[model samples]
Each structure stands twice: as structure tokens, then as C-alpha cells.
Target: MSSTLVVGKVVCITGSSRGIGRACAIEFAKHGATGLVLHYFGDDETTKEIQTLKQEIEGTYSPAKVTTIPGDIADPKTATTIINAGVSAFGRIDVLVSNAGICPFAEFLTMPQATWERTRQVNLDGSFYVTQAAANQMKNQTPQGGSIIGISSISALVGGEYQCHYTPTKAAILSLMQSCAVALGKYNIRANALLPGTIATDINKEDLSDDAKREGMIKRTCLGRLGQPDDLAGPAVFLASDLAKYVTGASLLVDGGLFVNLQ
Candidate 1:
């Protein structure tokens, strides 16, 4: 039903070579997106995975279209390259997911200046660059509208120990999304943020490898388990689809009630 409704829509996802971005790409394809632009930084394995994912989806669904573009989100030129790739390959971008992010954990007092700057550049500046490019492209399209999804973290809402540098950037992302949503709504474009809590990905699993740390995370979650990538895929699709047509400048939490439980 939802997939059928989204047929022929073009969705572009950045940092899609792995993790939540990868999962969102596959999920959108399954839901009848006309074409997909999978953006990766420098991971060749992720590029190969995108190819494989395209083939696998095509095998099960008709008109399964997918394309891959590799670039650094921190570079403004690379953002332009990604948008150009999507427009050239798919004609128009119906949805843009700004999902590329990095977190260098350290206490504020001991944090290196370079580390803080890199986090802000990638997490905050990258979002702005990609959103600007995508919005421009969306404005020129026939439908005169598009959806922008910023992948933020629960850290954006609450401060975490040893993550001072990372959380501030995420908070900035939410503010950016809200401002974009208000400004772009007049153009029929919408922007929103998705905040995921403690998902068990390679980035988050470093501590989970320790039983004590892992158990502490599980206990803090109301659901009594860690989050999986798939948990985020559905919500992302909904935001991009017409189902959330009126939902803009809002933040959706997909953390299995971790935020509330922690409170």
C-alpha cells in the first residue's frame, strides 16, 4: 500500500554505503521509489553493496532503479556533485536524506580543537551544504516541492558524557532543520529531523562489546533491547512519503523509548 503510493518517486540518501543510510536506501527501493541515489564518502565496499542491493531489489520488484555517487559531504563541491548525479540519473529528487555524520568522543576539557572542528564541519556544515543543494534542485522541479530529512541523534536532545563536541553539532542540526522547514515551506518543500537513540551499529557497538556497558544500555531502554537499523527504515519512508505531507519542521524519535526511559 505505502510502496504502491510511492511508486515513481525519486529518493536520494547520503552516506548510504552502510549503517542507517544503507538500510534507508533499501527500504525506499522496496517501497517503489522510481530511482535511488546512494551517496558514499570513500568506502568501496559500500559502493559494491549498493550495486548488490540494486540487483537484489530488481530481482524482486519491477523498475527498481538505483545509482551510486561517492563524495565527501564536508566539501561543498561534493554536495553539488551529489545533487547533479541525482538529477542527471533520476531527473528529479523527491526526497533528500542528509545522513552522513561522524562523532569523535571526548570530554570537553580534554577535547582537541581539530576534533571539535571536524565534528561540526561534518555534522553541521555538511547538513547545510547538502540541504542547500537538494533544495535548489527540488525548487526547479515540476512538482515544486520535496522532502528533506536530517538524520540527527538523541544526543541532540540530551547531553551525554564524553560526547560534548558531538552533541552540540547535532543540536545545531535540529535548529537548522527547523529554520529550513519554515523558509522552504513557502516553496512547497518540507524539512524534518530524525533522532535515533542508541542504535547498535558499528559506531555505537564499541562500548556494547563490553557486557557491562551493553547491559547498562539495555537497562536504560524501555524496550529492554538495543535498536536495530530496520527500526528506523519505516519511519524514514513515512517521512518521505505523502503520508507525512503535513509533517514538517518536526523531530521524530526512533529510539525504542530510550529518551523517555532515561528521563
Candidate 2:
């Protein structure tokens, strides 16, 4: 049987230069999303990487038209720029993956107010701003609806030793996704959150590198492993595709069954 390709769909992913964001970009391209707005932030080296990623996607995959937008999602204006870049390039946005975020390990006592505020700015406020911008465009589009995906984490449901600030922001994102689901449903837009567990991404480099911590995590996970960036691609694709047409205000956990180990 032939598979249905999202050939005409446009997907905008924040923090698409590397890790899970980059993986989602490639996954979307592989599945035939015609227009892609890859969002990222950082220095010249990072910019070049994103450019290369764009090239790779267009060349290796289905030749999906890829555009790169760079900015800090913490800035509301940056969020506007991201959504506008996609609309301006594709004429419409069919799905949005609000995936840009930061998580630095800091003890609550030692973590300054600056760090806490910055975490909130990027994780919670940023998701809010980006979702607002995307929802606005989605509502105004001729077809009048799209998918809004919030990239949350397992820490959102369970507290972490050093993520006092980081965990709350992710929890807020889940609530925000639910809010968007109810508010935007009238316009046919759906909102949902994806929670990834112990993914071996750059953000977790320090933790994952430790033998004991790594072994502990692996042991806790029923799947007996840490998740890879590509592990999230399938779920992200489903949330952004018609397969999830009736799914909204839901949080899907992609954590290798670790959560159930809450003993």
C-alpha cells in the first residue's frame, strides 16, 4: 500500500539547527512536508550548521523547500519573526513545533534570580509567544487551522534534583498547550505537548556522561535505554499530521517507559 505524504504541508520548528529539533526537521522533510521553516539561534558556526542542515534536507530527502530563521524564542519579537518567516515563504503554516528551550542544572539555592528568570523567559514565555504568533497566523489562513506542538519533558511531571527552575517551565508548557487546545479549537487548530525522557541531547551532556547517572537512568527505563533524537521524530510527526486530527490538549510521553518506574 502507498503511504500518504504531507507533500503540501508547511512545518515550522524552533531550535532546528541540532538535536531533537534538527531531527524533527529531517523527519518532516522525509515524510514529504513541502515547506519547512527551520528556526535556530547562536553564532556563525551554528548558522553554518543550520544552513548545512537545510541543504542536507533538501538534497537527501524529498526536496522539501527549507528556510532557516534564527532568533531567541524568549523574545516575543523573535517569535513573530519566526512565524512571519514561515508564512512569507510558504504562504501558510500547517504545523508548528515550539521546540526551542534551555535547561541548565543549578541548585535552587545557588541558582540566581537571573538564571531562574531567563529559564522562564525561554521555556515558558517563549512557548507562549511562539504559540500565540503561530495560532494567529493559523486562524487567519485560508484553510483556517493547524497543529501547535509544545516540546515538553518528563521532568514536567516529576521533579528533578537540579531542575528547580527548569521543571516548572516545562510543566507550564503542558498547561499552556491545554489552554491553546480549548481556545483555538473553535478555529480548528489543535494543541498538544510531547514529553521526552532522558534523551541524549546536548542539553544533557553533563548528566548523561556520568557512568552512574547513565546506568541509573537506563536501569529505570523499562526499555533499558536512553532516548535518541530520532526517537522523538515519529511522535512529533504524528502530532503534526492528520493522524492526530482529533487529538488535542494531550501530552504524549516518549520516555522509554521510565515514568512508570515511579516507585
Give the TM-score of each candidate: 0.95, 0.97
Q: Model 2: per-residue lDDT, tens digit, 1-263?
A: 21345557999999888899999988888887989998999679769989899889888876589988888889999999988989899999999998988898999888899999999999999899999999999999999999999999998899988999999999999999999999999999999999999999999998789999899999999999999999998899999888889999999999999999877
Across 1-263, the per-residue lDDT of candidate 1 in tens digits comes to 33665678889888887789888877887788878888888677766777776677666666867777887788899889988998999899999999998876678898889999888888889899999999999998997999999999999999888899889888998888899999999889999999999988866666679999899888998999999887888899999988999999999988888889847
- Clashes counted in candidate 2 amount to 0
Q: What C-alpha lDDT does candidate 2 achieve relative to the native structure?
A: 0.91
Window of ten residues with lowest summed lDDT in model 1: 1-10
Residue pairs in collision within model 1: none
Q: Give Cα distance to truth, residue 71, candidate 1, Å.
A: 1.1
- For all candidates, the clash counts are 0, 0
Q: Which stretches of candidate 1 lie over 4 Å from their true place?
A: none
Off by over 4 Å in 2: 1-5
Cα lDDT of candidate 1 equals: 0.87
